[model samples]
Target: MAIVLGLRVLGIDFDDEERIERIESAFPAVSFVRLNGWTIAELHLECFPEKAFHEATDLIHQLGAYGELEFVEVVPHLVNTSDIAKLTGVTRQAVNKWVTHPDLGFPAETDFVGGGHARQKIWSLYTVNEWLSEVMGIDLGLELPPMNLVKQVDGYLALEGDPLLDGAKDFHASGL
Candidate 1:
């Protein structure tokens, strides 16, 4: 399984690429991906839970020394627009409209193609949930702590995709 820890480092300028580079340099093994202002470090696990735990602890300590690393969310996997539409019981076009329409307060896409090309938007579950609740006023019945509390405790919140989401990926594979 692949585990990703999204770290939102506090009190640092988001434009400080050098500082981020330094942290990445310190941990050569961890694969860090830059998102908005968050640093997502991915770890692929095969065996030995204890070893992985130790590695994570060591990395957290190193990161803590540099700045306050607030836990963003454990990325379950990436999901596209269709998957979201299916999950929310909405049409794909509606989802697209929601994303593109101004004043909708939709979360920014993780990736998207622009200018003549078809847009391939993607987002994490956490981002979607937060947007749904805060902006759309749709409660998903998920019992999650407030963002402030999660950040205060540096708690890692897992953003998991449901079976419907997994099946949607398969549908894409089968050219459905």
Candidate 2:
């Protein structure tokens, strides 16, 4: 099954409007969203779990052709209690009770945001899905790449800065 994956790419220059249009036209399957200004972007696309690393690498290379590719990593899907409820087709009360009851063995929240009444707990969608499948015997039909694989791919990509930098240097040297 093809699963949706978000590739977080940094240091891509999208100053050329024509280049942006060409990229979009060429890779219609990938949707790019600028997260913080023009340099950082999240590319959303669907691919089989086993092919995530290859797919991400190909994307980084393709985008590198347009501009510098500084970094690339798989962005995990995050969700709150309400999001969990919606994803699992359960009520908010049920999710709340599960979190409060340790015996249920719900995954711990990855982080907390805000404070007091506005506070919200965040959990990795991957962990939540795993818990739902193992403990609750529910399969939401969502296939996420394993965290270990994600980390491995991320580490390998991080270490590949030299090649990407070399490509950027060549691009600038050509005076195009």
Candidate 3:
């Protein structure tokens, strides 16, 4: 089975038409979206879990050849009440009620955006899915990608550019 991973790439110029074409040509399978100005590219890829780290590293390295590779991370999906409602085909009021009812054991918001009246609560998609399955007894009829594997891949990738960890050997053997 293939797992989908989201990658956040920073310090790359998306305005250069030639560079964009080259990147798209080289990474045909990756879906890239420019977000928060021209410097960040959000890339989505579907690949075997075992190959995620290597594939992400190679892609980042290739992108680095074009510009500075400041940071790269495997980001998880975040959603709000409206997103939950849309995803589960329910009303936003229902989601809000679930959140407000303490007996429902709904997961707390992972983040908050804006302030006061405009504030919106955010939850990890995985967290919400688990709540739906275990608490609400609802199955969305789809398996979420293995988040543990994704997190491990993210951790391994984080060690890639750390100078202090240079020449590190056999992370698994070391029981890291």
Tell me, by lDDT, which candidate is best.
3
lDDT of 2 at 168: 53
Q: RMSD of candidate 3 to the true fold?
A: 3.3
The Cα local distance difference test for each model comes to 0.55, 0.68, 0.69
Lowest-lDDT window of 10 residues in candidate 2? 167-176
**Tens digits of per-residue lDDT for model 2 on 74-134?**
6756889998899888999999998889799889899998899999999998888889899
Model 1 C-alpha RMSD to native: 15.8
Give the candidate number with the greatest TM-score: 3
| C-alpha positional error of residue 147 in candidate 2 after TM-score superposition, expressed in Å | 3.3
Off by over 4 Å in 2: 1-3, 10-19, 33-51, 69-72, 160-176
Q: Tens digits of per-residue lDDT for model 1 on 1-176?
A: 33334444444455677865676677655556666545565443332443444444456556656545544454444567888787788899998888888988788777754446775778766788878778887777654333332232233222112434544543332323
Runs in model 1 deviating more than 4 A are: 1-76, 112-119, 143-176
Question: Candidate 1 overall Cα lDDT vs. reference?
Answer: 0.55
Which pairs clash (backbone N, Cα, C closer than 3 Å) in model 2? none
Tell me each candidate's RMSD, in Å, in order.
15.8, 7.3, 3.3
State model 2's lDDT: 0.68
